[model samples]
Target: MSSELETAMETLINVFHTHSGKEGDKYKLSKKELKELLQTELAGFLDGQKDSETVEKLMKELDENGDGEVDFQEYVVLIAALTVACNSFFWES
Candidate 1:
């Protein structure tokens, strides 16, 4: 049986790939795909459809190599940041 953390790791990879494969590079997410992933996967945290500038800003910030696409490394930064935020919120609550 997989441990909880292992399952969570798998889930992250799976989710990224699910969106990343939609167009362009199969391994990275294009701006549109990233927007879709954010809007669909994180509707609660980010209303991506409502605030396109936020998505644009995030893509620029997260696209470390500036290749105009979000690679796995860049994507993980977002996940990690969100995780940290969630952890802090849990502690505060």
Candidate 2:
């Protein structure tokens, strides 16, 4: 992965670990776990007034396989989207 992607993934993993109360471990998340984690940790950021529907749409778009869970690749895309969203929100406001 590129350095930026690596950093993003690291940030994501840390965020996941922190929220899941499994800090200091490198466990991979199941699809259900990922969904719950996102809802818990990212719901507010995602549901910002202007982008709530857009963000939900984006999540559905990424869950193409419809497995009701995102694997690592899908998770990475979600993280990337959120990172961009967050940066835009803070920097543009």
Candidate 3:
């Protein structure tokens, strides 16, 4: 059986691919793709956003290369940050 950590890692990759390639580059996430991924996968967390620029803000932050798109590595960074945040919240409680 795959280890728990292995499964989590796999889920990340799978989720990224599932929403990617809808527009440009099959390997990267366009702005719309990223928005869809966030809205669907992170509805609970992102639904609280009151700013219309939230998606644009996230895309800007995650697009470290300024490429206007998020590749796997950038997506992983976002996931890892959220994981860390969740870990802290759970442990602190």
Candidate 4:
């Protein structure tokens, strides 16, 4: 059986692929795919946002290669950053 951490890692990869395969490169996420993934998978993080530029900004920041898309490594960086934020929030409370 997979450990919880292993399962979580797998889930991250699966979720990325689910959205990444929808258009353009099958292994990278277009801005639209990133928006859909965020809206569906990370809605709570976006709940306070009031502008559509949020996704645009995220795409800009996460596109580390300046290739106009987010590959899995870039996506993993996002997840890692958010996880750190959540960890801090929980431990601080």
Candidate 5:
């Protein structure tokens, strides 16, 4: 993977860790775990959106296989999408 991809992955993993309340090297996050993490960490940014509904929408959008869970690959896609969106927003402003 490219260094940029690696950095994005690491960032997402760290976010996962923060949400899971786990520390250092114990980085096994499940789909539900990721959903909760995203909701909690990104909730304020999501404004007053309903947490469950927002997570569900995100899961559906990111989980291409209809597996109802996001694995590492799916997580990467999610992060990439977010990165692009953030970049576009800041660049436009």
Candidate 6:
């Protein structure tokens, strides 16, 4: 059986692909796909930030190479950032 961390890693990859494949660059997530992914898979994380520009801001921040899309590596950075935030939240609680 896979370790908990391994299962989490696989879930992350699967989630990314599930959204990334919805449009252009089956390997990368377009702005629209990213927004959809966030809204669908991370609703709780986004519920507090009702800003209409949130997705655009995130796209600008996460598109490290400035390629106008989020590749897997860039996507991982976002996941890592969120994970860190979550860790801190738990620690504080």
In model 6, how large is the Cα lDDT of residue 78?
A: 94
Model 1 over residues 3-93: C-alpha lDDT tens digits? 9999999999999999996889999999999988998888886743455887899899999999999999999999999999999999888
When sorted by lDDT, best at the front, the candidate numbers are 4, 6, 1, 3, 5, 2
Q: Which stretches of candidate 2 lie over 4 Å from their true place?
A: 1-8, 14-31, 46-59
For each candidate in the order shown, give its overall lDDT on alpha carbons.
Answer: 0.91, 0.61, 0.90, 0.94, 0.67, 0.92
Q: Candidate 3, residue 61: CA error in Å?
A: 0.7
Q: Identify the leading candidate in terms of TM-score.
A: 4
The candidate 3 region of ten consecutive residues with least summed lDDT is 44-53
lDDT of 5 at 75: 70
TM-score to native of every candidate shown = 0.92, 0.49, 0.92, 0.96, 0.66, 0.93
Model 1 CA deviation exceeding 4 Å by range? none
* TM-score comparison, 1 vs 5, better candidate: 1
Give the alpha carbon lDDT tens digit for every residue of 10-79 in model 4: 9999999999978899999999999999999999989989436888999999998899999999999999
Ten-residue segment with the worst summed lDDT in candidate 6?
45-54
Predicted candidate 2 versus true structure: per-residue lDDT over 1-93, tens digit per residue: 569969966777777665442322234444445555756777775464544455455557777677544455676777778679889999999
| Model 6 TM-score relative to the real fold | 0.93
lDDT of 6 at 39: 93
Per-residue lDDT tens digits for candidate 6, residues 3-90, read: 9999999999999999996878999999999989999998987798964588889999999899999999999999999999999999
Is candidate 5 or 6 superior in TM-score?
6
lDDT of 3 at 79: 88
> How big is the RMSD of model 3?
1.2
Model 3, 35: alpha-carbon shift in Å? 0.6
Off by over 4 Å in 6: none
What is the clash count of model 4?
Answer: 0
